[model samples]
Target: MPTKELSPTELHLWNIVENNPEKIAKMSIVKLSQYAHVSTATIVRTMQKMGYGGYTSYRESLKIRNNSNSTFNVLNEADDKIRSVITKNEIEMNNTLHNLSYSTIEDSISMTKQAKIVYIFARGLSESIAEEIMVKLQLTGKYCEFHSDPNIIRTIASKIKKDALAIFITLNGETDELVAAAQKLSKNDIPVLTFTTNKAGKILAFSTLSFIGYKSKTNYFPEYEVRSRLPLQIMTRIFCDAYSVRANFYKSN
Candidate 1:
């Protein structure tokens, strides 16, 4: 938090960005200079000399640098503080992973036993994971499928029987189109499950269950962005395993 020991250019840029990242996040070098003590040429030259393509790339780099810095600070604050202070984030994330794995398994088992149709809805990166979930759950011989596009999802939702279940993945839990499809399914007496960062969002109300996780705090490190793909992937594995075990048990019974 202290500005001490920062390079002169770093200090200037920090001062400009620290007060208003919203505006700074959208500024050109000329605008940035008007907001800071640094000049336009100084901004461009320093940025290029620092190996940036231009001021914009350099400004984007600052956001990564700041997130990394926050992660560092998170690691530095007393170990006890870090341990006990779940920061409203860690709590939500861990809870989400736990609840999803358990409930999804239960749901999968019940669906399998009853031969209920399954569908998954996820866009963006998690769409791939949803595909995998569908495939793995498909091994139980339940008719499971998913589509990443809202148009396709809506079509499927319309045809899903009243006994079917769907799991919709929205990392932020605020996708209007995705939640709309989920809502449509719910209105027809179908069950919906949601995976997101905010269970309290409208998706939760639309779904039979909602899982919330914050990927923000866990995705960066000093000097680089350490991808959170592993943790997310591992959780996905747990979910599949739980589902598989339950599904197999039902088959044997």
Candidate 2:
């Protein structure tokens, strides 16, 4: 879909479809347009951007998938649970890829190449992804610092040079400390790049460039606070690989 390239009206229509996928599966193009308060042509264009030939095919596919899922629900419980998890992870990865903007990625790579030093910040599970980025960028011969501590992040944000780049990785992107640090960095005219699963995250306002990944809200374990980090990992892997290629090319040139 590359939703970042969508116009405001298209993005709005996408949000409506995304939030109410099951309901939308039953909707006609005219009905959806009326519901979304946009023209039918807008709805058709939005579906086309999602790689559908038209609204009818998109709705049909969703209906078929829903029917298949209903039929699959009668399977053995344990095997079904495992298969469902795999399916959800696959969908998340696919959605993340579709939402990614190549231009934004290239700009981020260029910014990293120009920076004297890169400061990476993350917490919890995201710290692992940040660490991977730190190590990979360092291997490309760039000076990098990785921090997971909130206090250290704020301190570094205050003291970082103007030419330095700050990359923040967070699942929700509402971390108070990270937002504060991003605000501080922006105040000092430092470029901030953010990777998050939340498109409307507060961190985006302070970011010079932001990449949004997909994370399913399905709670497989309602008893615990576990969620998939696969989307973030996928985004991190792509960015690191692209950065490495660009860095090597520039070095050789």
Candidate 3:
């Protein structure tokens, strides 16, 4: 969680939880609130703010965490480039699975399914990814529009209906044009969905729902180039596939 996302009271409560996560699983909300010197309402509000439905859901999650017993081991060195690629992708996929917020993904899928129109905005290499998303959704009989041009994006975003959905794909989430377009959508009361690197950025602040891919390190040389986009690509595929399955189930029923 980003510091910018937390209120002063929430931050205080979060600090306590961070320092005493194991104890939190055993403590009731009332006890936790009392210990933090805040009201139960504060605790409930904090849970909602952090994307949980309520105290019970959040508490149950904490309890589940306390019961988890997982271990990790480093991958062995590969004998060839092909083997190395597979090994690295496996590691990155695990990282993404560990870091992903399924609640957020579900929320995004719900919004997309309900939206009157879906607009996908991206630039450069991400524009191709956006087009792929558009095609995937369209193939499933979902209406989608793709926009990579800044001027066109701003124009459409300003005019889109509140019931429409805006999906922005940016690796860093700091592109000036995309951020400006997101702001426009925000002002119009349209929901903005974003896929970006795990680093905290302004775009996430503008998003109604957000998904984070594993962060990639900076490339320094040809041999060390961070060329793989498996994390984001995997997230995109999962979302599209999930939505398609849901759509089919609804139609079948």
Best by lDDT: 2
For each candidate, give its TM-score against the true structure: 0.53, 0.65, 0.65
- lDDT for 23 in candidate 2 is 95
- Please provide, for model 2 over 61-99, each residue's C-alpha lDDT reduced to its tens digit, 9 standing for 90 to 100: 677777844211111222223447677887787778777
Better model by TM-score: candidate 1 vs candidate 3: 3
lDDT, ranked from best to worst = 2, 3, 1
- Relative to the unseen true structure, what is the C-alpha lDDT of residue 156 in candidate 2, on a scale of 0 to 100? 81
After TM-score superposition, what is the CA distance of residue 205 in candidate 1 from its true location, in Å?
0.8
lDDT of 1: 0.59
The regions of model 3 sitting more than 4 angstroms off are: 1-86, 218-227, 249-253
Estimate, for each residue in 32-107, the C-alpha lDDT of model 3 and write its tens digit: 7568986444555566677774455565577667785432332333232333545566666666666666555555
- Better by lDDT, candidate 3 or 1: 3
Q: How close is candidate 2 to the true structure, as a TM-score?
A: 0.65
lDDT of each: 0.59, 0.78, 0.72
Query: 2 or 3: which has the higher lDDT?
Result: 2
Return whichever of 1 and 2 wins on lDDT: 2
